[model samples]
Target: MLNFSNNKLNNEGRLRTVLDIGCGVASFGAYLLSSDIIAMSLAPNDVHQNQIQFALERGIPAYVGVLGTKRLPYPSRSFELAHCSRCRIDWLQRDGILLLELDRLLRPGGYFAYSSPEAYAQDEEDLRIWKQMSDLVGRMCWRIAAKRNQTVIWQKPLTNDCYMEREPGVQPPLCRSDDDPDAVWGVSMQACITLYSDYDQGVKGSGLTSWPARLTSPPPRLADFGYSNEMFQKDTELWRRRVESYWDLLSPKIESDTLRNLMDMKANLGSFGAALRRKDVWVMNVVPEDGPNTLKVIYDRGLIGTVHNWCESFSTYPRTYDLLHAWTVFSDIEKKGCSGEDLLLEIDRILRPRGFVIIRDKQAVIDFVKRYLVALHWETVATADSSIESDHDGDDIVLIIQKKLWLTSGSLKDTE
Candidate 1:
């Protein structure tokens, strides 16, 4: 089952609320929340009823309702998040309306995420249904995994923003519209029929939401490092754009391009942090870097203050991150629109002496990184920022530096 925790949901002090449609008996998402008020919807079945009752008995706010029913019993923009976990979407005739209704209930900009419905074998019906369901959601997408199962995420555009529907007159179409109510539901009905057909043909399986999981909130910005607000914002965009551009360049080089890029930076850092088994490593992280190409590894500050807040909830299975790495801190490397010796010095602190650092930064940052590293007494192992440059008067710099071994506690500069 999928869960949305404060980490993914946290945004500048905003209180969080979630609605899980096709919310089965176990209430997977509700249990992970720090607060209550999770809305639950389920199909009309004794099994579902017993599940909702169990959740309520355990003090989880739950309800029994059919998906897409007009009587959602909730007001406009009632929640900040609406999630679906292994909803019987493939087998429910009315799930189309349910998806639309979930959109209506979501505040503009609220997340509408669902993780379910693995692609069955290469059966004709399976592929057809897969295309139909995916096309129904806006082209916006994210993955929880790569194989048979996939998680899709989208957002209800804010009140002032418009959706990417077919252009009324001359513009190119960005995506196929699911505005046609009949067309949308028609595909869903067929999927339902297909699943039932399978069952009738002697296939049997329980739902996938039975497993339990927790959504987590990552660490807070600890003591402010030397970075400034202006620099932070600029670096954030720079890293994102650079990483995206790198993905574009690197795609053809790999077989599974998307998977490779995802593993390159942010996703890699996230998975790495989640896999922590050591106490010392648990406290380290690759945090966000505002500038381009800098990785955001590690919490905002030292791991000292964060362990307590994290332990409050995940005491038995606490979060552990030893070192920050990859695209997470790439922003810190690029220097983006920023250029400063002090800021450069801050970046130098993130590394453990003698540790290796891979940075894809702005062309301007190369000289700075070199100067900074030499100043910090680091030994350069290898450095290159796509040595080939375009004829255009612009380029980015890359540097690969490693903390070198020292025979004594004295600085490398002293030896030199």
Candidate 2:
């Protein structure tokens, strides 16, 4: 163990995000919630029929994904820890490419906790694997932080010193200078180390504050996007008012316990989810692939999200979210030569039956989506104008709708 304190984990809660690879039923993530840590539990839809499904059912954040040929739909350096416990992944396959993927996901000085037979088993095969994995991570500039029982924790270096000191012509070489670490959508996993930036190389860890403070304070990465603290504060205040108005519309329509899993389809700077911290819901903040790379900003704030393209389906099972928030997502995709109707269908597939959707966009877009409500089995709950007084355009609208709890003929025979 890392000898964490009673009140906080390492680095005064800077170590908040976790990537639990092959999380069976997400029990690890479930236990982490009590400690103010949020883990993005990932598993592929394979022999494990419904592991991610069960995790979502229990209100834990999860996604159906794997470290395969394609990159995981997340920006680089998003998690403080990457964990795999008896997950049955071949770390040494394809020249340790799978382990390199973890290296890309982890932040500077991040930790990877491996609990597998190779760590404790003494058989010949296990020993060979353990030796290879050890050498692979050693070349990748990772050191054993702790090893006990069946677990061996490795910590990534905080600077590029170890990498620069490596011998020439290493098997797994450094990524090309032109490679973008944050470019993950539809990208392939490369078998190379992603070096830290000039700023990150100087810092000890991610220049982030503690959890609650990090939530409100302007993150250090804001400067990377040329965003000012004033802008962050103004955005935060705007979302505060908008969320209050949203609760006013939703409070009367459903009970308090109705919503647990939520998704912000077009999260900008993640202010919307930040404003909802007091609620008992966990929001999957999504930043479009075409937009600014603010997913790192979202992570620095102690929140979780992924980089996605609305043109494609989200990486999750059907009926995974209890509520979906769309702030001009349909319009943004429309501008990209994508169909709004198809986006609506994808939304319907992910939203749970009887779930709620709040769409805020111009009047023309709202009218276009309204035409499909009947065919989609959704009913309008409320519609209102934007609360901002400066919106003199008089076309901005907020349309709230609820997905009907209807069943098809296939399930009609099911009766208790």
Candidate 3:
């Protein structure tokens, strides 16, 4: 209802990524898939009987999380839309911190579609809430894009003009100049607005292309990382060739329906996920927290990912991914003084039985992981040298392993 035509919403790809808070069963996300939109359905792991599990089983992208104290794992400007349909979140609590978090995630000129009683109800309490919400969003420089029936959509400002024009000493102040909006790994949520960068100040929106083109086009934010268009193109081509080789290696060992949910443990520029566009599987690209903040570049390319540190466990539930791709992840974490065995255990916890793992790293890391294969109930599928000819050092190895299906004593009796 934001006056968006079908062409604009579905074809133009202006609204590619979405954040669906309190998504129950993720039916809204499932519907958006036909329009080439991917929504990250988020819900809390509460007494609601594992709603996120049902969403995952339906092949919809979902995560078990809440808008709590910590920032969502994603980087700033990661989503083009944020939706809440009777999500029951108190947006006015704690100086509107939750709504501010949404502001951080949304791209400039992004929309928030809120559907709740406060928008339409005439009761006194509902009116009070509606007034408070309207004032809060107004202070945040969000304007009502559209309102109909019980739903109202608010659009964030396209630039920092409104923020700069705000009266001095506003309630929700702009974030400090030193604040890194992209630093989200285990970072606390701030009740402040993140001003646009100097580049964004001059631009209207995120300066990103549409979906298919965005998948291959060099993102404007690449300049923030000092990356040239040539480097981005080369990275894309490299992943394309590497993915082809990966499929060739996996073709014999797996059926067509084997790999559905995939993850890149250390996604760099999201080229790995972009290369797999033709495949039926969906990749959860993960950019390491310690590395360059490339998650924004990943989002600008229209791929989904999060900022994460391999030292700790991922935020999802156990047995979430069908295939895990670790390229230099073990070595990188090792250099950071994290335990490789602990990481291996965490991987085993997240990978489903019979799932696959592709680890491309130094021979030493492969040897270190191989030592725990038997104990982890995993078997080596295959090992090969680096397919890329540029690996003259010859230390790079591709090790593929599969988690074996096993039943514990506590579950064996139930099966019988």
RMSD of 1: 21.0
Better of 1 and 3 by lDDT: 3
Task: Residues 105-207, candidate 3: write the lDDT tens digits.
Answer: 9999999999999999679999999999999999999999999988999999999999999999997999999999888877899999999887777877788
Model 1 agreement with the true structure over 154-194: per-residue lDDT tens digits: 55444322332334542212223333211221122111100
- Maximum-TM-score candidate: 2
lDDT rank order = 2, 3, 1
Highest lDDT: give the candidate number. Answer: 2
The CA lDDT at 264 in model 2 is 97
Candidate 3 Cα outliers beyond 4 Å, as residue runs: 387-394, 409-416
Model 2, runs deviating above 4 Å:
6-11, 388-394, 408-416
TM-score, cand. 1: 0.34
Model 2 vs truth, CA RMSD: 2.0
Could you report the Cα RMSD, in angstroms, for every candidate shown?
Answer: 21.0, 2.0, 2.0
Provide backbone clash counts, one per model: 42, 0, 0
